[model samples]
Target: MFNDGAFAQITKRDKRDAMLINLVHGEPIRFGVDNERGVAMDSSGRIELVDVVDVGVENLLVHDETADDPSVAFAISRLATAPTMPTPVGVFRAVERTEYAAAVSDQVDAVTASQGAGTLEGLFASRPTWTVS
Candidate 1:
C-alpha cells in the first residue's frame, strides 16, 4: 500500500506529466495513475479513497454517456476490453502496458516492414504516453 501523501504526490506528478491524447470523438484523455482509488486524483490534487479491489480495468471504460460523444466509442471499447487484474499497482500497470503495447502494435507494422527490424525501441515508440506509480 502507498502512503496517502506519497500516493497523492505520485498521482499528481503523473497527471501533470501525462500527455493528452485526442480520442476519436470524446474529451481528450491523458494517461495517469488510476487505482481502485477513484480515478486517482481530484481536480484539487487530492487523492480520494476508494475500494481498490473493485476497481478493475473494466471500470476505466469510457462509455458514450460518460464520454458525451460517439466518436470515441471505438477507442473506449478497446480500452474497456484491455487486460485487468486484482492486484494493487502491478496489475493495473500490466494491463495498461498491455493496452499501450497493443496500441503501439497498430503502428509498428509499417515501421518494422520499412526498417526490416522489430526492436523494443520501435515497439515502445508506438505505445501511448504513460507513467507508472
Candidate 2:
C-alpha cells in the first residue's frame, strides 16, 4: 500500500458514502472508509462502507478472492531478473513456378534469380539463384 492512502479515491459524494477499494498487498485486504480517513482489514471479509452522510454504499459491490500469488512484491522481484523474449527477424524469398501456357513461357523463364544458394542448395547443384533473404 502507498504511504499516503491505503485506498485510492474512486468517487466522492459530499457528506455521503465514498466508494474506495484496497491497494495491492500481500494480505487479504478489505477496506472501510470514514469521510475523515481510510481503514484496512487483513482477514478476508466483505468491504465495509460507512456513510459520511448516509448509512451504507448505495452501489452493489462484490468481492472475489483470486488464486494469484499473494505476494505482489515477490512477483515483481522475479520479473526484474526474467529473460526478455528475442526480437523477430524478417525473411524474404522469391517464388518460382512452371509456365503451363505457351504465351507466358518467356515471362516464366524471365523470373529473376539472385546470387546465393540458401536452403535450395540441395535441389540445385549450381548456386541456387533464387533471391532469398
Candidate 3:
C-alpha cells in the first residue's frame, strides 16, 4: 500500500545516510552554535567550539597491555551425508594482526639463518631505490 513517491524519498534518504556514514567514522555533528558573547582562543591559538561536547573516545588505539585477547573462536560448518542441515566439524581460533606479523618475522629469521642475508630481498620482483642529484 506504498506510493512510488514515498518509496523514492525513502531510497534517497537511505542513500544519503549511507554515504554520510561512510564519510564519518563515528558520531556526526547534528547542530553547532557560536556564543555571541565573546571570542576566546584556546591553548593552541585556535577558536574552540565550546557548545559542542565530545562524542566518542579521542584515542582510537587500545593501549592497555593487560587487555583480554581479542581473538574469536569460530566453527567450520559443513553439510553431512544423511541430514541436509550443516554440522560443525572443527573449531578454530583467530589471531590478531600483530600475531600474524610476528609469525612472519620468525619465518623470515629462519630463512635468513639457513639461506644467509639478503636472500629475501632478491626474491622480490622489484627493489625500491632513490637517486639524489
Q: RMSD for all candidates, in order, please.
A: 18.9, 21.4, 21.3
Residues 1-133 of candidate 1: C-alpha lDDT, one tens digit per residue? 8656643422454543232222322212223344223222335543232344555443333222333334333323333232231112211111123577787896787776878776688878986779898
How many residue pairs clash per model? 1, 0, 0
Per-residue CA lDDT of model 2 for 4-107, tens digit only, reads 53222333343123333333432222234343322222245323323323323223222222423334323222321312211111111122445568547555
Worst 10 residues of 3 by lDDT: 72-81
Segments in model 3 whose C-alpha atoms lie over 4 Å from true places: 1-98, 119-133
Native-vs-model 2 lDDT?
0.32
Clashing residue pairs in candidate 3 (N, C-alpha, C atoms within 3 angstroms): none
- What's the TM-score of each model vs. the native? 0.18, 0.19, 0.20
Each model's C-alpha lDDT? 0.37, 0.32, 0.32
lDDT of 3 at 10: 20
- Best candidate according to TM-score: 3
**lDDT of the structure predicted as candidate 3:** 0.32
* Cα-based lDDT at residue 82, candidate 1: 20
In model 1, pairs of residues that clash are 36-52
lDDT (10s digit) by residue, model 3, range 25-98: 12221211121111123465432222233323331121222324422111111111223222222222233456
| Top lDDT model | 1
Error of 2 at 100 (Å): 43
